[model samples]
Target: MMGLLLSLLSGLIFGAGLAISGMADPARVQAFLDIFGAWDPTLAFVMGGALIPMAIAWKLRKGMKKPLAAGAFDLPGTRQIDKKLALGALFFGVGWGISGLCPGPALADLAIAPGPAAIFIGAMLGGMALHKITVE
Candidate 1:
């Protein structure tokens, strides 16, 4: 119960951050990715800002025995760059480049622009289902 509540709180905080940082705006993300054209460096700064807290969290995780709301620290055990990973990354990059939206911001955009966001989310889920059927 606590873990679920914590997860909800964490998600809300993350979504709020995405909204406040203008990450929910697809045009802003597209502009940021447009390095060859009228490039926007705001996303770079947002990423840089995110790194600070991420770094701190990484450092803190080393000393922690368990998470606050969970029984154990559930972290990724693998660090290998396999074929599946590469292919997935390529697809993700292509999708992001074309749509200017990723999972996090796309979810956040649901409140702001439901039409586009819902379409993106639907496609994303479809892709996931297809991947599960074919790959996994």
Candidate 2:
């Protein structure tokens, strides 16, 4: 119950941030991805802000043998750059560029513009289904 409550609170906070930052709008994200045209760089700052916490996590996970929450490490130690990762990233970029919606922001938009968000999320789930069928 405690973990569930905390998860719900964190999700709410994240959704609120996405909504307030105008990132929940697909048009805004599409504008950000418009590199050759009238590019909006506002989301770049948001991405930069996110990098700080990501860097901290990277450093800490490198040193820590065990995670604080579960009292055991849940991270991989490999720093290997590989082909599968590159292809996955390319696919993710294509999907994002085409739809202008990432997973979290899509969830936030679901309450407002249901159509695009719903289609994006449904396709995401279908992709997940395909992944599970192939991989595991």
**Tens-digit lDDT string for candidate 1 (1-136):** 9889988998899999999878879999889999999999998998999899999999999999997788998877899999988999999999898888999999999998999999999999999999899976
In candidate 1, how many Å is residue 109 off?
0.5
User: Candidate 2 lDDT (Cα, whole model)?
Assistant: 0.88
lDDT of 2 at 49: 99
Which residue pairs of candidate 2 clash?
Answer: none
**Tens-digit per-residue lDDT, 1-136, candidate 2:** 6656777888999999999989888888899999899899999999999999999998988898775545576555787879977988899999998899989999999987999899999999999899899999
> Could you estimate the TM-score for every candidate?
0.93, 0.87
Q: All candidates' lDDT scores?
A: 0.91, 0.88
Q: Which prediction has the highest lDDT against the true structure?
A: 1
Residue 136: error of model 2 in Å?
Answer: 0.7
lDDT for predicted candidate 1 compared with the true structure? 0.91
